[model samples]
Target: MKRVLTEAELKDLLQAQPEWKLQEGKLIREWTFSNFLGSMAFVNRVATIAEEAGHHPDIEIHYNHVVLALISHDAGGITRRDAAMAAKISTELASHTSPKHE
Candidate 1:
C-alpha cells in the first residue's frame, strides 16, 4: 500500500535533489531556460513523463522560468512516488544543462 513520506525520509530524498526545495509544504523545483520555446519544450517533456507515470505536477511557466510542484492528492501528501519523480526531473535537468557533444 502507498504511504505518505515522513519528515526524515523527505529530508533524505531532498538531499539528492538539491535543485528542489520544500516550499509552502510542497516539493518544488524551478528551472530557467534561454527562451520561451525552451521552457515550453521542457514542459512538454515533463508532461509526457508525468502522463507515463500516472502522476501529475503543478507547473507554472513564465518567460524562461518553470516551477514544478509534486504532491500526491490521493495519498494525502508527499510519497515515494513524488521523490522518485523529483529525482527523475533532476536528472533530466542535469542532462538538459549539459553541453552537447557532436
Candidate 2:
C-alpha cells in the first residue's frame, strides 16, 4: 500500500505545485473559466489525465468554477502518487488555455 507523504515531501509537493493546497488530508486545487463550456473542457482534460494515471480525483463543478481534490484513499491520505498526478495535470493544462486559479 502507498504511504502518506512525509513532512519534507509534503513541503516539496507544495513548493513544486504552489497552486495545490494540502487540505483535509488531500491535495486540492480550484480553477475558474470564462464559461460553463470552458469549465467542462478543463474537466474533460482532467478526466483523461486521471484515467491514464489511474488516480481519480474528486471533482466539483459549479458552473464556470471547478475544484479538484487528490487523495490516496487506500493510503488514508495524500501520497507521492497524488503529487505526481497533480504535476501531470498541471503540465497538461499549461499547454492549453491558462487556467484561472483561485
Candidate 3:
C-alpha cells in the first residue's frame, strides 16, 4: 500500500501547492471558468490527466465552477502520490491558453 503523508509533510506539500487546500482528509482545488463549455473542457483535460496518473479525484461541477478533491483511498489519507498528482494538474492548468478563473 502507498504510504500516507505525515502532518508535517502535508504542511510542506501545502506550501508547495498553494492553489490546493487540505480539507476533510482530502487535497482539493477549485476553478471557475467563463462559461459551461469552458468548465467542461477543463474537466475533460482533468479526466485525461487523472487517467494517466491513475489517481482520480472526486469532481464536482456546477455550471462554470469546478472542484476536485483527491485522496489516496488505499493509503487512507493524503500521500506523496497525491501531491505529485496535484502538481501535475497545476502544471497542466498553467499551460492553458485562457486564465483558469473568470
Is 2 or 3 the stronger prediction by lDDT? 2
The parts of candidate 3 lying over 4 Å away from their true place are 97-102
lDDT ranking from best candidate downward: 2, 3, 1
What overall lDDT, based on C-alpha atoms, would model 3 receive against the true structure? 0.88
**Clash pairs of candidate 2?**
none
Task: Write down the worst ten-residue block by lDDT for model 3.
Answer: 93-102
**Model 3 per-residue lDDT tens digits across residues 1-102:** 999999999999999988888999999888878889988999999999999988899999999888989899999999999999999999987765243432
| Candidate 1 Cα RMSD (Å) | 4.6
lDDT of 2: 0.89
Against the reference, the lDDT scores of all candidates come to 0.82, 0.89, 0.88
Poorest 10 consecutive residues of model 2 by lDDT?
93-102
Q: Write model 2 residue lDDT over 7-99, tens digit each, in one string.
A: 899999999999899888899998888889998999998999899888899999999989999999999999889999999998889766456
Q: Tens-digit lDDT track for model 1 on 1-102? A: 579999999889878776778877788877778889888988998998899888899999898888889998888888999998988776766767422221
Per-structure clash totals for the candidates: 0, 0, 0
TM-score of each: 0.88, 0.93, 0.92
Winning model by TM-score = 2
Q: What lDDT score is found at residue 47 in candidate 1?
A: 93
Answer with 1 or 3, whichever has the higher lDDT.
3
